[model samples]
Target chain A: MKTLYVQGNTWLHRLSPGLKLGGLAVFSLLLFATRSPVVLAAAVFLAGAIHASMRFGVVRTWQQLRVILLSISILTVFTLLLNGPADALAVFLRLVALAVLAATITATTSTAEFIDTITAGARPLERIGLVKAADLGLAIGLVVRFVPEVLARYEAIRDAHRARGLKQRPLTLAVPLIIQTLRHADEIAAAIDARGIRGQNNRKLGEGS
Target chain B: MATRDLVLAALFAAIIVALGLVPPIMLGFIPVPITAQSLGVMLAGVILGAKRGGLAVLLVLVLVAIGLPVLSGGRGGLATFVLPTAGYLVGWFFAAVAIGYCSERFVGRSQSALVQVTGFFMAAMIGGVVILHGLGILWLAYGTGTGLSTAFLGDLAFIPGDILKAAIAALAGRAVMVGYPLLPQRA
Candidate 1:
């Protein structure tokens, strides 16, 4: 299972996670506000520079983005077929550039740093009875960690199905996958309990402690 | 404090965020862009239950709102919500809640794969698909100045894919229940 993060010691990697997160937020807003290909292209170039400076190989980035690139290609072709060449090009480039910039942020930042930043930023919301920031942070972390595992499990199950010569039946693959997933969830719940990790109350108690 | 649980939560959230990096595939016949985001939503609900599920989604949304671009097609920010897809984005919250509620209610504490799978499917379909599409289609109609019937037509393309996603969510949710039985339970 390939990790999404790129290991590097560049300026991007050196920046505080909070600052980088803040910057990314600001930039995303800018992207949403502007539909201009020129500005989008410029943002992409800057993102590329950051990635390059971190010594994350462009080829590796492309490899990670292969699915996205393929999707964009298909979408571009479809748009061209339905609409026109100019509109297709504009939408495709805008979408691709946005994706690349987002990926760069993920590749550069550590999961821990991102969570911390979010927790810190969410402090204000904690007062309104929306959620406890720490708990929210913890939950965020779990989703991040487990998504890949679920994907990997799906692949493993698919491979097992192939080995069993049940290649064409989707139900055969799906049933076992669901069954296995439940089993995994049960164990995880047990482990959490055994470790004595309480929910929101625990966080509050910890704060008191 | 169990550092492990904390670690696990962080890891799962990252997976959700990373999955968002996958671009949206435009279905030629449908207005909805096919993306892996619903998978993330389903996983969050299954793994974290209602409260944590909602939290996990909010985390990703925060990243997107702050400009991290953790959304399908790498789109992010407040402006993304204003787009035609904004309704779907907002619907993720209720979807998680729906999934979490059904999983806990139907599956109980047994963690039986059958029950878990059934519960998850129910939740995903009700929350992620039915309710989500309901909100999304309405928003699409309102935003584009199209009639409800036209909006329904545009939304039809998503039904097949959304059903497939519901199936996947069922399987994935069950797996999580089995593998990580220590997941926080409602009192």
Candidate 2:
């Protein structure tokens, strides 16, 4: 999964990923714990201001959140019909605040920095033999890199389905997509084997110390 | 834990993330849209078995924890875990494990192709749909302050599409079992 990271020299960009993630966690917890519309609206205002402080202004941020807004609208309308406008407004504000805050962090933090922080965070888990920190880092990198590739393959399969004058049947689309994906996995497995990047082997090598 | 296993886990996780890129099939009647990502959960379980499949999903959840836009409609981050739909997201991990465990039991000894396919479909439905939706409804109720019955009724619209996903997962599972049996064999 590619992050929404864009290069910028703002202070938010300069902040450590750990701090950013930690702050996001604390802020989100507070948002969920409270139900007061006044409190929630204030939180939303603060979040929006923080987002504006980033290089990407409110307009672009709102543009990127079009899908989220749509989803929120659905929930908002449901709340409106079921509960009342008051409940709907509260839900809408809460969702918008949380989503924008998250998108801002992703937009500011580079992927490499994010992965580095994750690897550093995982180092403590190695004591319990949960996972090799380095292996976890590499695996995450592989996942991030591979998501777009698989999406591309999905597009290719969909186009082929279209070319065949087939109705966009989910079943037909899924079978080929899975087949192509596993085939690609086979190739990736072979490459990992060839590169000698085995996790167990690496653990063995580390144990020699 | 071998290189190949690690690669397989990562690859399947990527497939899960990739599935999220598909535009969700929105039904006007349902609050929750039909997303392709859940199918990846079924596929992982059917193809990779319990241990690796569970790990594959866990890996994706970790990515989500750190705020990657990996969920359908580009939703992610720690906040999402506290949202109403959070149960479905959390359910993915356990559902993969359940599907994988049941797939082994259901399909492990079946000789007839029909039985095997049925087993696959049943396993996917039991784990991927029933369990996931059950948890999803509970969370939706709590999140929205709605009654449990209301939430359960609200989720009924998902049944038809979810059954289709199960069928597709079953067919795909059978095809992989025959054409490319790379999954680790477990008792």
Using TM-score as the measure, which candidate wins? 2
Q: What's the C-alpha lDDT at position A201 in model 2?
A: 64
Return the TM-score for chain B, candidate 2: 0.88
User: Which candidate comes out best when scored by DockQ?
Assistant: 2
Q: Write the per-residue lDDT of candidate 2 for residues A1-209, one digit (tens) a residue.
A: 44556679888889999998889878877877888999999988988898888868667676657766676787778778888888778788888888778777877887778878888988889778887778777788788888888889889988987899866655566667666766675577667656767634654442232
Q: Compute the DockQ of candidate 1.
A: 0.17
Q: Name the runs in model 2 displaced over 4 angstroms.
A: A148-169, A184-187, A198-209, B22-35, B62-70, B73-82
Candidate 1 chain B: 10-residue stretch with minimal lDDT: B1-10
| Residues B1-187, model 2: lDDT tens digits | 5655676778889988988888874434545556778888998888777777887898899888766778887876555664666788899898899988889889964368898899889889988898889989988877766668877878897778888788878988887776666545451
DockQ of 2: 0.42
Q: How high is the lDDT of residue B141 in model 2?
A: 78
In model 2, the Cα lDDT at residue A121 comes to 89
TM-score of chain A of each: 0.67, 0.79
Q: Which ten residues in a row have the lowest lDDT in candidate 2 chain A?
A: A200-209
lDDT top scorer = 2
* lDDT minimum window of 10 residues, candidate 1 chain A: A167-176
